[model samples]
Target chain A: MSRLALPRWSLIAALSLLTLAAAVGSLLYGAVDLSVARLIAAASGEGDRVASVILFDLRLPRTILALAVGAMLGLAGAALQGYLRNPLAEPSVLGTSNAAALGGVAAIYFGLAELHPIMLPLLATGGALLSLALLFILSGKAESPLTLILAGIAVGTLAIAGTSLALNLSPNPFAAMEIMTWLLGSLENRSFDHVRIALPCIAIGTAMLLWNGRALDALTLGEDAAQALGTDLRRTRLRLLIGTAIGVGGAVAVSGAIGFVGLIVPHLIRPLTDRSPSAILLPSAIGGAALLTLADLGVRIIPTTNELKLGVVTAFLGVPIFLLHLMRERRIW
Target chain B: MVNIVLDHVGVTLGRRAVVHDVSAAFAPGTLTGIVGPNGAGKSTLARAMLALVPANGAVRIDGTDVTAMPRADLARRIAYVPQGQTLHWPLTVERLVGLGRLPHLAPMSRISDTDSAAIERAMERADVLELRDRIATELSGGERARVLFARALAVEAPALIADEPLASLDPGHQIDVMDMLRAEAAGGGLVVAVLHDLTLAARYCDRLLLIDDGRIVADGTPAEVLTADRLRIVYGIDAAVETGGEWPTITLFGRAP
Candidate 1:
């Protein structure tokens, strides 16, 4: 009968439609607007060459990336929260994003990014994996959620310190400016090359995280009971860790640490689901895509001296809602 | 019917041995109670038998080793209800009970008619059918315990193991749960419970296992294992045992000199 507050399929379909609308808005609403007629012609490879170039070369990649990166972050966040059984967990909470940012910054600092086009994402993914390994070592046989979160906080703090040290020891003002701009995080001018690098990892990682839904459901009964119910907690934990690392790793490598989508999107959509950890994943992913694409549009639409950073807009939007959530759930907390 | 055998089972948590080298066999159609004083490792021994803890030697169910069995397969055969678990998520009572069907269903599959019926039966059996719509986190301690018991019953497994299942319940509910366990045993299910109440153990259990310092010090019928001398040695108290009625009743006098 009425098992769920909101039916899962309806919520998914609604969020999917919203994500599509936001994606369309992202494609059309830019500094230069290409009309629908021109856009269709360009997509089929026949109309105004300039409009065609703008659609294919610039907007399409940015649109696709915003959707993919946002989906990855949202999925990763939901997975982490389910795995940790903690509402406070997110993609960056485990230090993977900070580690990725550090990796990207190190590439910039050492001038390796200049050597090749693929250097940044490669190094960033490497950093994420390394941090995950260190996380396991730091929280050996992580039997408790508290232990993992503490280790994550420690690793994230270290990675943040490392990134700041790089900023403090800048070789030149231009290089410093370059690092600073990247750290602010944007979807601007992100080519299909960026998408090409991030997509494979995100695609694989998405499948891994999604596969963990049942295991996450079992864990709601607590670890021992879950195990007694035929859940292999060790396997479940491994999948969430590697899945979050690669998925969020790929995303942060491309978008330069776009925060809040991972942290807040699940909270936003959770009330719409049956509130099972599994039921929240798809809606959160779709909602994350919609939010980021819409936020990207906002950054472009606002009349300011410079285009606003995407992360700044998300932080501004996320904080008040997060605080409100905290207030509402204060008794539970 | 399922038979559970623990062959030289031992459990070491960190560097300390919580359950020592223990071997026991439980038959079908019997309610076997594991009785012990606090910190006597009854819970650890139950976990070891269920293969929840990392244990040495073998836990065999129906001639097959539990360690080698797939988790879902094992879960389908034996239902376990662990004690004193806090609800991590605030799911409704019905949904929480439905999780017992997880071992039977494929991933992402909807609950079939069979599952729904099982869930309903479990709720009715555990006497929580009226609490189906209630949020499990908001329930009283006794109600939550029954709700969890309903979750285990929903499994409909051939064997059931419950640790401290009678804790946090009123006397009437405690009697009800003991009756339910006896019914499970009568229905040809192997039922094992770790109990703290000596009178309940003596009344309901077909066999009583008295454990002390991680070892089974006595294993027999309640009258044999719950004598005044064993009570004085194991619990370190003088207890008056009255067995003239239908069941033995133990009354503690004072600490043993």
Candidate 2:
């Protein structure tokens, strides 16, 4: 229906290629340059041992995590926007990221993160579920988007205050520093274990969101007409909230609260879509993967005293575009 | 074609009983107009009958309770157009109309030729064929109303219910919509519309249901329901009703003293 954009399938294909290219770039460009020929040789177990360790142990897991986490954020953002019928709706607006951050902070504050490798992510995911519970209780049976968003804001603010309190009451300077660094978010030195913790949950959450595409399309007509067209609003809301929690929870468990991927990617990809809520989901996911993969790549290339936090880079990149978008859409509101 | 039976249906919204124990039967081949004053529960009654709201009593379609029916099956039998909806996205008019086929679509499936045909026919019936490529959000109020009507028509259901369908239309377009509803009824489909214009309801409807304070005050032909005394009592208006012509017409003088 959108005349200026390419067809949906071709757009998806192009975005997929871009994401793949960014991923390849991510593997190739790092502090110690590893040539492609040597990288391939290392994969086959006959190249330099150092090159093999760098390729297999370091970059591959980080690249895979970038792809998975980016896709999850993008998909969740698009789905939340569709369900809420608000352009501003994203994964963070539902408070999952903040809650996950609070969980990670709690893990560091209590010295439990050192107890086991999986305890941090486990508690972080539990925190995300807790936010979901709080949101449900606050919203009650009201189906209004404003009500849900207000409840999310309430939960998110509370989580932020809790995180701040933990930071203020530091057991030691090193523990406080660890909490701050984790809160900033990163993909550096992440192993395959992190990948395993995130992937299955992201996969399940992605499926749940994609399955509601038709219901989201129906909602373009408003809640009453959507229900008349057989969209079960209550069930759709539950699925979306749970899907976002699981997907974003798994992501932030490993990568901290990577801001702007969810909020900015959908807007970037929207013009390339038919502008229907359903039409934006898959392309936004791929676009998110490309954007984050590219941003993570930029962090490696940019010369700095210390590696920039992924969330900081995303916020810097996101704010200008978001402001421009707000300016353009101000008339609509 | 279908028959809708509302048996002692009542709706309560947030501690306020909006619609009382109202019962009625609407069969195919007739257009029924529901006319009532503001806050008189006409819309709530219609919503309760369609199972769009939680209600105390049973609403059956062709002898099956609507609450027991799957939402998609209920949607297949009845298409609804709600009141004063604002489009959230800037989708094209054609795609907006195609949303009516959602009930017929399987997950991840593209719209088939049959669905496209229904969409085209619905646009033609609502006389919005030329606006198919236009952005729905940019349309004028009248055009948007017609486009939304086209979307409802695209469902091609056995029955149609429209609430305030003529709110923003011009006089000519209002007549056109009324004509379309009449044609739908004449084609052996059940049509129910909530109307505020007494003259249009009187002229186009086969039967009129007059409601006041969540109760059906009058029910019959327009002549039976649009009496001067009933209008004064129900609507709180001093008005004159003349039925000598083709259809009854009401002339308002002032509010009741």
Candidate 3:
């Protein structure tokens, strides 16, 4: 690596190591103290039954769930930031995540959540695709930054209002109670089932999104220039829309509407850009994963009778950092 | 072969007719300058030539109508350097210039050695090689203009069209850019520019198309078209001409008869 690339590689390496250490800590130091030795013994098939149950059944899934969800959020968020060229543009901005949440809530209310294991996720994915299509249609031919933002805001508001109406008309306590989690967002009791449902979608979305980094780099100049450089504007936009829908749709299908992971992570990692879009993308994802994982970890450490919502933690962390960025942007402007 | 031909072109943005019934030709290996007073449709005419705006008539490049040609294929033949484009992102000059190679690069092709060499040559020609690694946002206005020009040059297009590129530069740099455009035409590539300075137009351009009130008032060689009468009629100025060495530099006295 050149002198310039060394810092980023080391930063990624250091963060990856920290993430692994934290995952182990998360497994070991949760509501009950469970040692890694016990975890290993459980894995090796010889340990105390209760300890094995705690380590293998409860803590392992929860800890691993956090890592997977964190990575998904980070990857999805980074892609949105890169494509929109706006640090503030998150997956939720497009309304896809909110729509997915509405779909999940609707599925649960219809009593189909137990009938078909993946019904919520499937319906949620459909909702996400619908919202994405709505956004693109509203955006029209002018995919300029201001227009895209306006379209996103319009679609997101509609989705939220629709979600509210759906929850308000339903009298079921479970359906009504789901509204709070869907809006505020959470990852409590997220199990291996959740992991299995979301992973393939996230992986496919990540590959599609990461492939467009060069096109995004070309777009930093402007759409006209990118077109001149052989980046078909319509094609690139389609890729972004599909990938964002799948990745974010998958995460929100399981976790409900998580927000701000995409909004804050890429901004934090922009200084390491090295003026290359591809170089910035993976680091941006790493930063996103680390930020979300740590934020989730914070939710765990905070004292509460019930677990704090993960979205609440992100908003608390993200809003203040966003203000700092706004102040900095104001200075620049 | 037709390098670039505008057929009865007109452009009306919203409600105002900016360019009306104006037609022109930019043959290959020739320097053409679009010159007129402010609001004389120089830019609108140029936009029609590149099919950037929806106009009544057609813009044909090498006998193929630009409207009918694939946008990418058209982009390969013609490179455009827009004037007064502010850089909102802090990109390196090399990175900015390297984008010009995008037209020729296949989907799977990384930046090849050929692309690098072309970019290097364009930077050197534009005298921005030393500042390759410098952030474009930090450059002086003239430097940025050249960097953008170098980016278009790196496209290796058969024709280049620049819009009022001389408006922001000092006298020396303005002449330098004009001379570069002249050299580009001399090297068998067509160059079309909207120039503000009448004296530079007289000296550097092979042909001049002067416009007034959305109409082509005059078009020909420097001596046949840029007469004192037409200058006063179009510009409402008392024009004076002085011969220095080999070039006749026309000076606009003022906005007075």
For candidate 2, list the clashing residue pairs, or say none.
none
Candidate 1 residue-wise lDDT, B1-257, digit = tens: 88999898888998999888889999999999999999999999998877888899899999999989999999999999988856787888998999899999887788999999999999998889999988898898778888998999999999999999988888887888899899989989899999999999999999999999999999998988899999999999999998787778999999999
Best by DockQ: 2
Q: What is candidate 2's CA lDDT for residue A184?
A: 90
Q: What lDDT tens digits, residue by residue, belong to model 1 across residues A1-333?
A: 234467888898889999999988888878998788888898898988898888988999999999998898888888888888887689887899999999999999999989986898888889898899989999889667788788888889999999999999999998888888888889898888899989998998899899988888888988888888889888887888888888888888888978888888988887777677988887888888888898998998998999999989988877976787677779543
Q: Over the stretch B1-257, how does candidate 3's per-residue lDDT look in tens digits? A: 23888889889987999999988788888988888999998987887777777799888888899888876787788888775754545678998888788777776567899999999999998999999988887898888888988988998899998889898799988988888898788889989999888888988888899999889999987766688888888888888766544666787678763
Query: Arrange candidates by lDDT, highest first: which order?
Result: 2, 1, 3
TM-score of chain A of each: 0.96, 0.96, 0.89
| Tens digit of per-residue lDDT, candidate 2, span B76-152 | 99999998856889999999999999999876789999999999999998889999989999898878888998899
DockQ of 3: 0.34
In terms of TM-score, the best-performing candidate is 2
Candidate 1: fnat, from 0 to 1?
A: 0.73
For all the predictions, what are the DockQ values?
A: 0.81, 0.87, 0.34
Give the per-residue Cα lDDT of candidate 3 at B79: 84
Q: Write the per-residue lDDT of candidate 2 for residues A301-322, one digit (tens) a residue.
A: 8999999889889989889777
Q: What level of docking quality does candidate 1 show?
A: high
Looking at model 2, residue A297 earns an lDDT score of 87
